[model samples]
Target: MDALYVPQGRSRRFVEQATNLHHFRLGIFLEVIDLHLQELDNRFNERNMELLTFMACLSPKGNFSSFDKENILKLASFYPEEFSSVDVMTLELQLDVFMDNMLSDERFCGLQDLNSLSMMLVKTKRHENFPLVYFLIKLMLILLVATTSVERVFSAMTCVKIKLRNSMGDQFMNDCLVTFIEKEVFLQVPDEKIIDHFQNMKTHRMNL
Candidate 1:
């Protein structure tokens, strides 16, 4: 395979090392992907999945109302952060009252997903009526959403803060990342105004 000339100072294995780069790269890549998938497999245990499914009962769809009250109560009792001792004790009572009240309210009856149900509760001025139950719903949503959200942010940062921008400081990089990630927020800002403000901060011997 001696097809090309090698530099006089280089090792004979230069061609071999070039070939090994792809092998090493693929090995590390697959290893990372496998670890991530394996972690997800371990994290999503049956009980956790069942509890999350039970939490979906708050939604109006999927025969949500037919969910077992005792199982729901047990799940509520387990999450002390969302439901304290006193709160947990009366959670079932609250749940029963919430279901009764919700079914009667036309606004709540029309709600479908957990998100819509959570938001509609506030719009209907009923979030306060079932505070603990509402908190549980919100907590479940935050748990489900916030986990993926943080992961997405880090993933984006890896793309954004590349080798070219590696010298950028942490605080400045964070600002850039925030601007990059929040596309809607960034869109509303006028670029000219930003340039003018920055330009005004320090005098430059150039036309504005």
Candidate 2:
């Protein structure tokens, strides 16, 4: 709290708010990673089914009934208690109903297809020996997205708290910060010309 560059009262409040936001974001990130792991496992476990189904789906003359049957059997084996004959019928019916609803609703029609999603999930699995490669690529993507977001927020904050306009009310400051963070963007530019270019661009675009 003392190191946050705020008064004691504000520091306490800011720290609490920051902690809650941190926890919320952390929870989301953890859940995403966990889901990724589950997807990788599913990909590895169902590689055969995935390959077969994908090939069938892509072929003009190929039939998917056999692949579908095999997938059901595999699922039943993996979750015997949850997926029996009755459960399979129920699942298929539910899937049909869901697809029907999606087709009828404009909001849902643009959503990703489940079959494509299933194929993608299966294709993302890597060998056990090359775990680092996949993780490194994922880490790089995450870092790129995160750094871009942070940079955008910092840029907006700088505009909000300019040298001559530093005397902001507390409520105004909070609102500005929130707006900056929520509407953050990532722009690519060389570091050497960044300062000059940013000022010129802002002036030209009237974004400042």
Candidate 3:
């Protein structure tokens, strides 16, 4: 409570008909919260939620069927930049070909995520051919990466440059943060091999 900064207006905010601003009853606060929640409920009512749920069925993670093409059409209808009328018409054939390849090939069928699927496409240099699907997958991947990277950078900054090391230089801090953030990558690096390489680089230093 001592560390908390109370803004002048917010600290003295009155609840309902109460004249005393300092008085904050849990019941009164709950009433205010109830109204706010009611507003949210009205905004995101049943119809909106049902539409969003139907959209979730567009995910290729699960088994995609012929029935889901309508959902795909709906998705393309929303985005005109990537999917044109001609593009939408071609999507059905592209999807059929993509799914058929997946069915015939073991490696393609075994993929569980869009990232892996995209990588396989790039590996075979087939991603450019399926513009809409690949671009959609890539867009989703970029969003996921950008979101996770922000959270990871903050987490890494906390670990790498704490209050004691607050005066750390920008470049130095960035370097340390990068190392701390990519723990999985650093884990693969052998310390003994690194030490040996360092020792090998220094030839003039003798055993004296």
Candidate 4:
């Protein structure tokens, strides 16, 4: 019997190519629009009345279709208190709406501009709102948060499974997992007598 062969569909390949080209065109359009909006934001920054008016309309519940949702989220993360000073609940609901309706195009357009806005919010509010400022002060906090907290939790879970008894009873495994999970909490415990016992054990082991 001769070996059988099949070719991929040419029409499917053509459709994929067309879709990619359309996406590229949209990406270019969003970039050009972003350049113009940036220039507008810069021009309006010093014009306080226009800036505040623009800010207000972009408020969480402002009745405008053109308000940028990404800008509101960026502002909220950076200046939660100030951003909350105005109709906070409305803004929060608006945030929910924007988050739900947010598109890839808006994300691509607003990311850099939002970064700059975040920095400005941090510097401007640092004096009075130190704790909130600390939250927004770092640009890499998003990465930091994901890597340290989330990754570490998963890592600890894996470590517990690997280092402990694989065939142990489930309840015993649960207890071990909890012990590993709250390692930091144990470190913060101020039991001096327990500390002395550990120190003595270490000293005995070293002597051996």
Question: Would you list the C-alpha lDDT of every candidate in the order shown?
Answer: 0.76, 0.47, 0.67, 0.49
The alpha-carbon lDDT assigned to residue 199 of candidate 3 equals: 78
Best by lDDT: 1
Candidate 2 global CA lDDT score: 0.47
Q: What is the lDDT of candidate 4?
A: 0.49
TM-score of each: 0.65, 0.26, 0.44, 0.27
lDDT-based ranking, best first? 1, 3, 4, 2
Clash list (residue pairs), candidate 4: 60-91
Residues 1-208, model 3: lDDT tens digits: 2232344555435423343333243445767888999987875688546545444543445444322666656666666887889988887677667666655766665456667778888887777777776775565567567757887898788888889899999999988988888878988999887777777887757621
The order by descending TM-score is 1, 3, 4, 2
Better of 2 and 3 by TM-score: 3
Determine which window of 10 residues in candidate 4 has minimal summed lDDT.
102-111
Error of 1 at 185 (Å): 2.9
Question: Which one wins on TM-score?
Answer: 1
Tell me model 1's lDDT, rounded to 2 decimals: 0.76
**Poorest stretch of ten by lDDT in candidate 1:** 15-24
lDDT of 4 by residue, 84-178 (tens): 55544455555554434433223223433334434544555532433332232242345335546765666676777673557778787677777
For candidate 4, what's the RMSD? Answer: 16.7
